[model samples]
Target chain A: MVNEQGYNVALVGATGAVGHKMLETLERKKFPIKQLTLLSSSRSAGKKINFKGEEYTVQEATPESFEGIQIALFSAGGSVSKSLAHEAVARGAVVIDNTSAFRMDENVPLVVPEVNEEDIAKHNGIIANPNCSTIQMVAALKPIQAKFGMSRVIVSTYQAVSGAGNLAIDELKDQSQAFLNGEDMEANLLPVSGDKKHYPIAFNALPQIDVFQENGYTYEEMKMINETKKIMHAPGLPVAATCVRLPFFTSHAESVYVEVADENVTVKDIQSALVNADGIILEDDPSTQTYPTPLSASGKSEVFVGRVRKDLDNAKGFHLWVVSDNLLKGAAWNSVQIAESLIKNNWL
Target chain B: MVNEQGYNVALVGATGAVGHKMLETLERKKFPIKQLTLLSSSRSAGKKINFKGEEYTVQEATPESFEGIQIALFSAGGSVSKSLAHEAVARGAVVIDNTSAFRMDENVPLVVPEVNEEDIAKHNGIIANPNCSTIQMVAALKPIQAKFGMSRVIVSTYQAVSGAGNLAIDELKDQSQAFLNGEDMEANLLPVSGDKKHYPIAFNALPQIDVFQENGYTYEEMKMINETKKIMHAPGLPVAATCVRLPFFTSHAESVYVEVADENVTVKDIQSALVNADGIILEDDPSTQTYPTPLSASGKSEVFVGRVRKDLDNAKGFHLWVVSDNLLKGAAWNSVQIAESLIKNNWL
Candidate 1:
């Protein structure tokens, strides 16, 4: 199917929430693609998708589906990526997986293009994207880390329901309407679909994101803690996270506290570092009541930073409010940027 | 109207949210009241409030409103408290003010009955109820600090829209309905009612809580920091807070990180401390997806503690999720409890 004008690219999980954004991002960024194949699970197969005024049919993915594919983006689920990512890689395709499958495999490079693009070059045919919560925190922290060394990080997140998937989005919509109507709000999926219990996410906050790990931290919380150290290349960094799912449908907002290694770093110093960073927008001005909210950052690609202030007691400690569209910069756009980086740097 | 059986009580801001809750709590707790005087601003003066099967008319509060008032509970705006609290005290009334007007005044005691009922005895006529967000956090941290001695505290709050007042609750409800109807969300009051800019709180998170202070922190955040030190009697304690307003209408949830001074402390130790502490509930069972959420804790009087986990790197540090009904424990119930202590201990 290759016309030799550009590289052959295949998108796995084309029916997913992140997948929908990935396709849109690839088209908007004008990614080099000569032949585009859409793959999904058997349940979602035979679907039609319109891209750039062209209609494409989705097919159930098999190992043979990746033949001659130069680039593959996987985001269906962990099991799907676990079973099919190697198949795609074995077929001469570089995989940028958005699941937690091979992120800590030691052979894979976990990357946030803005934070750790150089690690993409060392991928063994498959690169891993960090969690949505981790991606935004690291994107905002990288600039500060580059200018002033960071000693510790503690973050608490207000995440969106879209990160749970499309069905979860539907659940929020239904529940919000029910709650507004003074009716009983029914919940089928939230907090986690596979978890033992489901809680309502409309006009409420759920403290759990993923399944609880053995060490008392949720898998989502551990992913944020471990992924930040991996992407920043500081294996000994002390990071703590408490991930809570709010009722929002788009962006994830985080309250981050960082202790810098350098002495006498003021709030101005932190603002100067983030304002000039590659993919960050600083919107902090308390006098004008200016700051980024989930609604304001719903569709933006760049990470938004605001509410910067110094810890009243600790001279080196600073607090920041970081917000970004979880589907865009957190997953889809970050994955597409990795594909672009591979082609730009001749890493593939 | 004073009788020999019970103390005469005066309720300020009788038509407001906290004032409504105050009436409900006083009735539920069956506080001894021979006569009740309802007072409010001029706009709400004629509003009729039903209390204990009797209808009471709210009167415009003046300097003479507290004449023979044994206990005057003020929940109106800070300006009303600043102008009338001292006048109420001058008339031989014990004022329990639920505003920031006298909280930082050295002569007044900021009281959370669960943590520091003894501090109520030190009040110079006016006892200040700590901020709602602060009351819940300190109630959770007090037991832990008493058991292991805390050194530093970092908190990120998921506060409800009702914390801003009744109009904010209406704004959230109206905007949420509009958002669900595919209409634009109108914003008239949120983050701070008197602040220059108003952001929509429907399915959104606003980082600013109270008006911003000269120190680049919100007045709400500063209240948390300074009041925590004062209530805990630890002047050198390092406390940092980021207060964010979410769309929830009732309860406030907090993700707290505390560094205990003890050499070694486990999650079990922390839970045991909270389970035995007064006015605290331990609802942490990760295996069953148990945790305290805003919706679940909306009407509860106790502080709900869950998701207790030790830090991965520091053995002395721990993280906890705390939730409580802002109107009850954070405002009305707490203020009423202080009044009860004043009567029970004969401190008035």
Candidate 2:
């Protein structure tokens, strides 16, 4: 698979936060490509990106943006991906979408490669990236699910502002400064910027991350609920997420409580599985005060897991604290990994 | 009862983080203090602290230090509290100890007055201040517990580094600066100051807040677990906690999941209970993106409660976020309130 001929790769929305990381991941992972095309919105069309020390000019993405591209990576907002992803797919490109646009489409494979690489082969051109919160949970849970058969997942996330895009990061910084200076903070871009009210995140927690869906779960919440079922291949999995935006600028951290079918699985067994799992770094030495945090996971590509232990009274239940950089493994790198997978499997 | 003749108050660890706040709380609340004695490890002796602009010199804490001290407030490290608390108690001083040393001591009442004021009468001259994480949680859950019996509690905290002490706060600033400049960081405090290794908290989370306990729960976790039972007076209640230290300088936030004994207790009902609970402020309104945050709770006496919502599948379960300045409500003010309680209840 590593010796396979490289496919022609293209990056759509190549100038955004996750988009920039996509470039970094592609280069860092040594994702092969005979040729590369950079595409973005009209406003950023003329921007040039330097990858592997080669400058590439960005062109406005349209229906024809995928002309010779064999594989396309998308991290644009949902709207852009929804409008142009099909166009890229129609142009003979296997599109790996890093948006919620088509995750629950039922036609797409929601992949975290490590959790479900085989599912990626079933993709009908467009593969979806699971929610950042969901990605970390699944990456950490897949090993357990494979060995122990998990039944239910209850995750309450302390998500960073980066998952909302770069604007939220700026807002956090600006508001934090205002707070320290005794000035009135303008919370224009947090807890759903379009939502009527804004709460300060400098030292606050916003329960709602994205807009609420019809089922009362916020769009961010629904993504985790639906995507977990798709990635784990358990359609009826009872998954509940309470996602809150904290003051951090990067990395989404989760406190996941899971009920496993195997009651005999001890904490040592869970620790071994997590430590052996791909893309997971277990930092759970309680004696050394070792565990994950958003600040430490920032810019790292692996899902940092810690605080793994058995529930106090429940024999079949366990708890874990998982953290990962939303920009890297959550979106950009995961999207790029899918592109690399398609090339390795000769699907591109 | 509040129309009180003042009580004699002694502040142990008179020059530390919580000690300073205790002074502010006493002055701000105008706690009925007829006499004040300042005690610390002999090092802080001779140091002068001003309360309401009145000068008080710190004294060495020994058995003789509590000669006439009535209500003694202890926030020096656990060792100091452990050694001198019983000494003070022998001198007829009711010691409100802000340390982990006596929290689990069966005879010592772990009190959060709003939640378990009646438990105070059972104290054997030694009262324990719950962990900062547990303090805010019990404050928010007290009203909920009153309206509906709480069956189980699962909490993950986004705690401020200040909860570790004043030194960790300075370390955060220094490390953050070092990190921003692409420089290596030195850690003298954090996670656990006495631990062998120190990781940078510039953008990292250390799952350990204190020493590891025998049950595999960190001292911080055990504190939350045991203190919850003591404060809520629910011996049979199930409680679990994963305490995380964040980069924030002040305020500790928690994502708490609770399964109530009562059925169908709606989010609105929980909100209504928190709306008027003493030392609580309800700020949960999803449509308006309103919720409680640490910044808003900072500098305020009341714990801020928000993100109150019913669980999707479990009708009897609910989730709530609680935030408060760890120094204020969690330690200093709570200790001061204990002093006020002594005067109000005529216990001194």
**Model number with the top TM-score:** 1
- Whose DockQ is greatest here? 1
Candidate 1 on A1-348: residue-level lDDT in tens?
323488899999999999999999999998889999999999999999998899999999999999999999999999999999999999999999999999988999999988889999898999999899999999999999999999999999999999999999999999989998899999888889987789899999999999999999999999999999999999999999999999989999999999998778989999999999988999999999989999999888999999999998888899999999999999999999999899888898
Residue B137 error for model 1, in Å? 0.8
Q: Give each prediction's root-mean-square deviation over alpha carbons.
A: 1.7, 2.5
* lDDT digits (tens) for residues B84-152 of candidate 1: 999999999999999999998999999998888999989889999999999999999999999899999
lDDT of each: 0.94, 0.83
Compose the digit string of candidate 2's lDDT tens values, residues A113-151.
899998888888898888788898999999999999988
* Candidate 2 local lDDT, residue B301: 81
TM-score of 2: 0.94
Q: In terms of docking quality, how is candidate 2 classified?
A: acceptable
State TM-scores per candidate.
Answer: 0.99, 0.94
